[model samples]
Target: MIEKALQVFPKSYVYRNEELILEPRNNVYFRLVDVETEIDFKCKMFAWVSRPIAKSLNKYWAPRVLKSFNTLMDTNFTKSDMYLIYDRLGNDVNRKLTIRFIESGYDMELLKR
Candidate 1:
């Protein structure tokens, strides 16, 4: 599973801290929080697509695509501050979507916190 996940999420890394670790990405560290509930898990994902891709999608496909997918799962999406965010409960499909979004001449910005 780790190998498969790496294929989709090469930017993600695993590190250990003194119980709590700060993720280095600027948008990520402030944007995501892990929560565990009795029956649900919550996580967040972000995609930094190209400027043109982001602008084009902002005009049409983006909102519809997000809303359509949101209807199928416990997911909420937002595009703001030059990033697209998917906050969901259970499942990691957001990572797959992030990869697909990045495939179209888009790249993730690895920012220092």
Candidate 2:
């Protein structure tokens, strides 16, 4: 999964050290550490789990994940530029989640775009 994510975001720039951390709880957290300033910004992800499916599974197995990426800009980059990148990453994550669920033999209807 990490390798696939890296493939989605293959380029590295000089601004920051970004890493994606996924927990067993199905929570995806992104930490962006600024290289020069030594500051870290966090982005949390929320996944949509249907109530019926949640009850059936007896756990919070996220079917559709919605990522709201945010970071305070103290750097040279514009807010619009940051948001563009954030949205792209979010879209990539969404695609990955969909593919993973499909491969696991779960009904795709549990996930909605």
- Top candidate on TM-score is 1
Residue-wise C-alpha lDDT for candidate 1, range 1-113, written one tens digit per residue: 22222233324343442111112231121122342331111123233222222353545545543443333223443444234332211134455544444343333232212
Model 1, 27: alpha-carbon shift in Å?
Answer: 27
Name the regions of candidate 1 deviating beyond 4 angstroms: 1-58, 81-113
Computed on alpha carbons, the lDDT of every model, listed in order, comes to 0.31, 0.30
TM-score of 2: 0.18
Q: Write the per-residue lDDT of candidate 2 for residues 30-63, one digit (tens) a residue.
A: 5444212211111122121221122222333322
Candidate 1, after superposition: displacement of residue 65 in Å? 0.6
